[model samples]
Target chain A: MTDLDLSALWVSVQLATTTVLVLLLVGTPLAWWLAHTRSPLRPAVEALVALPIVLPPTVLGFYILIALGPHGPFGQLMQLNLAFTFTGLVIASVFYSMPFVIQPLQGAFEATGTAPLEAAWSLRASQWDAFLTVISPIALRGYISAIVLGFAHTMGEFGVVLMVGGSIPGQTRVLSTTVFEHVEAMEYGQAHALSAVLLIFSFVVLLAVYILNRRFPIHAS
Target chain B: MSRLVAQFDVRYPTFHLHLDLDIPASGITVLFGPSGSGKTTLLRCLAGLERAPHGFMQFGETVWQDETTGRYLPLQTRPIGYVFQEPRLFPHYNVRSNLLYGYNRIRRDMRRIAIDQVVEILGIGPLLERRTHRLSGGEQQRVAIGRALLTSPSLLLLDEPLASLDIQRKQEILPFIHRLHHELAIPVIYVSHAISEILQLADRVVLLKDGSLVGVGTLNEMLTSLQFRGSFGSHRVGAVLDAKIIGHEPQYGLTQLDFSGQRLFVPLQPSAIGESVRVHVLSSDVSLVIGRSHSPTSVLNVLEATVQEIREISQSSVEVLLDIGAPLIAGITRKSLVTLGIKPGDSVFAHIKTVALNEEVTD
Candidate 1:
């Protein structure tokens, strides 16, 4: 692999890892709320969270680009120009891969139901303690699925990263964007190498998810 | 004796539950009612699992919930143990870890019941290493009860712990629950619509009907009262007599139960001599005789008693409340009442046809 290809691969790995971590830290509470809440605005919030799943990547990328640009809502709040940077790529990947992380988690939490949690509470476990000890362990399969799918989906990000990150070499270029550049330049050999890497990586991640699911089923049945 | 005073009024779109109760803190207080009767809802309110808008609950001196004063203690902080209808054991943990989940969380000084004691009492020692999902229904319920007991709670709430089990499994777990009440000083509030459970476990009975408190009294009072008989339903209308197995007549396959100074013979039971038992005599199973007779007959129990009250039960039937060392009800035809000219304060002989020995109730 060329130096630029290796750098892009490293950048992709870094972005996927960072995005998965960020999603777990923030998305857990959001998914939990979505799973159990009965608020009237639940549908609206759920629709908004699920927008990236159905909307075209360019559409989501366009909005994210405008939102993070100078003088935009998020840009003014942060007081920085994030467009065309690696951080910008991360933000776009997070948006692109959110449903992948939240949906599975929300399903798992819903499957867990409130009985075990109430039992835990009756046993003197605090709400936080019960979630960590009871709810999380029971939802282990969902967490595994969420992590794998989120990572793989982020690794394959192209269109959103392109619009927001602009494929700046060493700073914002990733494996998918680099492969696009290779194919555009008629470098099929390098393109094949990178594409094969992505194909094998995604397959392995999905396979791991299935195996884990079988080993630790959601319930005894 | 401290009491648990609770007043809660919960309302939903189609159902409403309004009750104010004073339950004795010790002994097994059975919340008895039919489905959709709000018995479970009342239990939930006491546990703080369901929030009533203007509820007040106090256990002894500790205030659990008081909407008037705005002091409410949540379930986790209430110092209470709850065993749900389902085992509700954590699928991720083994039986040992599930039992210790609450034990490990409470303060060191608050740990009154040791793990070994709970395991021994519930007979869950062999199940400690096994996963919860692998346990039998009866064993799982035993483990669940053990887990709650390990918390050393001030009050234990059992919401039909045996409701999901088969009859054999319920029979298997009843003795363990009976033992918990005897060995542990912790108060228990048990909820069940099963009359057999009430006969076997309840020291006090609180009857609910359509989200309202029907009545609360000792098991004997509630069982014999005409007001609460409707709540118990017709088939369950009977008298519960506290008795002890005095002797066994193996020749005839009969066991003799002594209620006070009176002796009642029943089919041979597994319980040993001197063991206390509850004899349930259904009202429909008793017949009235004008005088005591010594003739041999199919009815093994013939006790002389004075009629305390005669209440009309149905169009053709009248329930004759008899005092034969204990309160016993006899459902006889109104024609016989007129034929024999039976009335309150008249001495009569009660011919009991069938008697059920609640062997699981023995302490």
Candidate 2:
């Protein structure tokens, strides 16, 4: 602990955890809406969910900073500046990792199948009950996969966090940006240790998710 | 009052279907038709799975839909039970969970059906612990029925529930449905293309063809009508005659049944006398005679019959349909018809022997 520099490693885990939690809460309804609604505006809603996947992380981070700056709409309304703050790192991570959490959930919901849902509906269950009791449990594995991908993607983020966080000490500096600062200072040993830890941590998390997902038993009723 | 009424028309690329329906308040009313007759579309409409352009379905005070009133009840809100061709049991649930999925979700104030009785009636009690995928085709179907019945629906819709099963498997699950009809007052709108299913299960039959309604009647009328005769052909065409068992011979395993003051001998091997039995007489096995034949042969039912019409059945045989106070049909070779000169209004004897009449289960 004394030899290894972990100041930015702790910040990265915090940013990844908070961003995954927020995306899960927000992406659930968004993915469900995309899968269910058939209105003419469905295409527009789908485009909004997909925009993050195609846009470069730096470009997305720039727009997000403008939106959360002191004079920007949400920031001005909240009477606070979020850009280059700890809060800015979370907001940027959420925008960059939105697609990873939502797309898999949408596919899983689609594959959960319609027969069991319809059967539950015919059994006099309300729509909410049918989804909770029938549809959600069937897609539990999908949710686990979504959370893992979102967390892992946020952990590895570089451009978005760098553009928004601006490398504040003990505040917004994450593991990826911390390595950049160490490289610029010609401190190769500290940079190598942090980068290697990030790599191994991400690989373990993703491997554990996939192996656990494969081993979970799905009981056919 | 008509508890269920739906009139809708849908256009498809290959076929056009126009459906107008009014079913009874109780018992099974089978929607019978061949493959391309839009039977499933009608059921899906009733289930609210398909949207109808100009459709209306009402179950008592609850109005399911009326395009004029700008009201449509989705499948979740409607008090309807549906059993599809394949058993769509929740793959993640055990039998008990699937069985109670609807039962526990709905308000207890609306509960009218006894869950235990439904489990017992379908004979799925022992199977309640097993997973759905482990069950046989017959067991899966029974669970599907129980799942629907536990909903306590006003009307049940069955779309060819037994079409996927083989003969013996269908035979196994059919008795449970018959018991359900007797035990519960909910009217079932059954759909099937097999006439034997219509005979054994349906109290009323609504026949369809080419996406149009052809005939609607009881078992006797549908079996006797000329329109249905064309659908069933000469082979599976048979009459389900309700007769009182007069006597039974424990030795030769024969039973005598009386219908309209006429005695007929069948291999019922009835266990109890005075029990009601159903006898089927095929049109092909019946041989007609002009006068009283002196030959003492195996022709058990050589009763007097009047030739009503000489309908050309096939290239080689002409069906001599008879009405000897009871509807009877006989298919004879064209040579026999030409030699005997049998025409309409001629008296004859319909020799019916060695015919297959299965033992039917009736309440």
Candidate 3:
């Protein structure tokens, strides 16, 4: 593979890994809330979280581009232009891959029920301690699914990175965008090599998830 | 003795629980009731799991909850251990780690219950290396209890810990629970609808029926009361006799119990001489004799007693309460009542057919 293609693959891994980390830190509480909240705003909030799944990637990318632009609300508040940068690509990927991380975590949290958490509380574990010590271990399958799906989805992004990050070489030129660039330049040979890597990597990730799930069954009870 | 006092008024869509209680924080106080009776709800309220809008609870000196001032101590801050109907063991850990989840959380100086002591008391040493899912139902529950104890909780709440188990499993776990209060002396609020459990384990009983408090008293007080009988269904009406093991006739496989200057015989108890135990006698198992008979009979227990109260439970059956130092009830036919003409203030011989030694081993 050419050095540019190798760099694109490396960029894809970095972007997927960073996106997964950021999503987990932000999505965990959101997913838990979605799983357990009784507020009337729950359905609306859920609908908002799910918008990225059904809405076109270009549309989400367009809105995110504006939000991170110099004059937009977030840009004005931070006073740092985030558009067309690695950070911009990551922020867009976080929004793009949110449902992939959140839905599984929410389902697992719902399945875990409140009994074990209550048991932990009764045994003198604070709320945070119980979540870390009890809920996290029991809902491990959901975590696995969330991390894998979020990473793979972020790796496969083309339209969002194209709109927001603009395929900057060695900066935001991820594997999917590189594949697009190769196909556009009629370099099918290099495109096939990178596409095969993406295909095999995705297959390995899903296989790992299934194998882990089989070894440690979903119901921890 | 310190008391755990609570007042809760919770209204669900279809049910409401209104109770005001001041119970001694010693021994096992059972919350006994049928399903939908709010027995579990009361326990939850005490544990702060259910935050009743109109509620106030105080354990010893700490005010755990008070809705008026909006002061509510989260359950984790309360020094209490709660075991649910299911074992609720942490699935990710082995028995050893599950038992120490709470133990490792508290400060070193605050750890009163040593892990070794709980393991020994619960007989879980053999299973410590095993995963929780690999353990039997009874074994899992024992580990759960051990986990709670290792936290050094001052108050323990058990909500039908045996309700999920089958009969054999219940029997397997009951003796372990019987050893708890005797060994540790932590006040336990145990919830169960099983009459047999109440008879075997309760030091005090709080009866509930359809979200209302029926009565609260010592086991004997509640047992002999008509309200308890009504709640328990009349057929379960009986007396709980606290007795001392005076002698064991191993040749005949019988043990002798002494209660209030009266000697009673039951199937051999595993307890030692001078050890106190509780015995249950079903009212249906007793028959009255007009006078002391000299003829040989299969009945092993015959005590001279005076009649106390007679209530006609049915058109054909009458429950005759008798006093043989301690109160005993005999369910006899109305025909016998009329034929023998038994009434209050009369002297007679009470023939007991069977006696159940509560299988509780006091430490």
Candidates' lDDT values, in order?
0.89, 0.80, 0.89
Look at candidate 1 and tell me the lDDT of residue B350. 91
Work out the TM-score per prediction: 0.92, 0.83, 0.92
Cα lDDT tens digits for candidate 1, B69-163: 88999899988899999999998899999999999999999999999888888888899999888899899989999999989999999999988
**Clashes per model (N, Cα, C within 3 A):** 0, 3, 0
Model 2 C-alpha lDDT versus the unseen true structure: 0.80
List, residue by residue over A40-65, the lDDT tens digit for candidate 1: 99899889889998999999999999
- Candidate 2 TM-score, C-alpha based: 0.83
Q: What share of the true interface contacts does candidate 3 keep?
A: 0.77
B271 Cα displacement, candidate 1 (Å): 2.2
Best by lDDT: 3
Name model 3 segments beyond 4 Å from true: A216-219, B287-298, B304-306, B310-318, B332-349, B358-363
Which digits, one per residue and each the tens of the lDDT, describe model 2 over residues A107-215? Answer: 8787776777777778877778888877888888878888998988888888888778888877887888888878999989878888889889988987888787678
Per-residue lDDT of A67-90 in model 3, one digit per residue for the tens? 999998989999988999999999
Worst 10 residues of 1 chain A by lDDT: A212-221
Tens digit per residue, CA lDDT, model 3, B42-70? 99999889899999999998899999999
Candidate structures ordered by TM-score, highest first: 1, 3, 2
